[model samples]
Target: MSKKENAAPTTHTSESLFGKVNYTWMLIGLAVIALGLLLMAGGNSSDPAVFDQKEVYSSTRITIAPLLILAGLAIEVVAIFKKPKA
Candidate 1:
């Protein structure tokens, strides 16, 4: 007996811009969020003595917030631009 060939395309449709494989981009977003939270919380906390608002002002918050925001934005862009897959 001969085997019948399939008619439908085996490949799936592309949903986003890059592709479904680009899911890792979302992880980056999560990492950024965690990092920002950590940094904001860390706030130059070298020793577990105490946490002061003044210290927070001079803490990594300066670095963390921007990084998190930027990373979040980038992830969003990737998610939007990337395609689902073929």
Candidate 2:
């Protein structure tokens, strides 16, 4: 048989890649935003209306906020690049 006649069969799936949004990415983005907000909230805000304000972090702990934020952003970006596990 000629090589052309023995070509591998290609299966066509009845779906478009752009048809759906990857929920994993949406979840990751939400988690990241939440974490970043939480980290930023760790420190005391200058609003008395915002009660339940306790300083769980200090000048030294301030580093944690940025770290968590950066980590969250990184995770979100990775999720975006990853294919949906389904």
Candidate 3:
């Protein structure tokens, strides 16, 4: 037999690093982070001279936004670590 005939044919398959579920989770995390950022932004006064401490230091900005951002980061970690189904 010739050398080429003796060698078995090989097939290569391309696969994604992450599955659909992981991508979905990542998207969710991104959305959550974006929401947190939006919530944390914009305490601007109409006059620009006046600084509203209450608006800048509101519970949503100080507490909720940060918490949401943390939660989103955690979700991203989980998504990165999650195993894809075979």
Where does model 1 exceed 4 Å of error? 1-20, 43-54
lDDT of 2 at 86: 55
Per-residue lDDT tens digits for candidate 3, residues 1-86, read 89999999999998999999999999999999999999999556777788778888899999999999999999999999999999
Residue 82 accuracy (lDDT) in model 1: 78
Model 3 segments more than 4 A misplaced: 1-10
* Ranked candidates, highest lDDT first: 3, 1, 2
Say which prediction, candidate 1 or candidate 3, comes out ahead on lDDT: 3
Better of 1 and 2 by TM-score: 1
Clashing pairs for predicted structure model 2, backbone only: none
Report the number of clashing residue pairs per model: 12, 0, 0
Number of the top-ranking candidate, with TM-score as the measure = 3
For candidate 3, the C-alpha RMSD (Å) to the true structure equals 2.6
Report the lDDT tens digits of candidate 1 across residue range 35-54.
77777765346766876666
Candidate 1 Cα deviation (angstroms), residue 83: 1.3
lDDT of each model, Cα atoms only?
A: 0.69, 0.64, 0.92
Give the total clashing residue pairs for model 2.
Answer: 0
CA deviation > 4 Å runs, candidate 2: 1-22, 43-61
Error of 3 at 34 (Å): 0.3
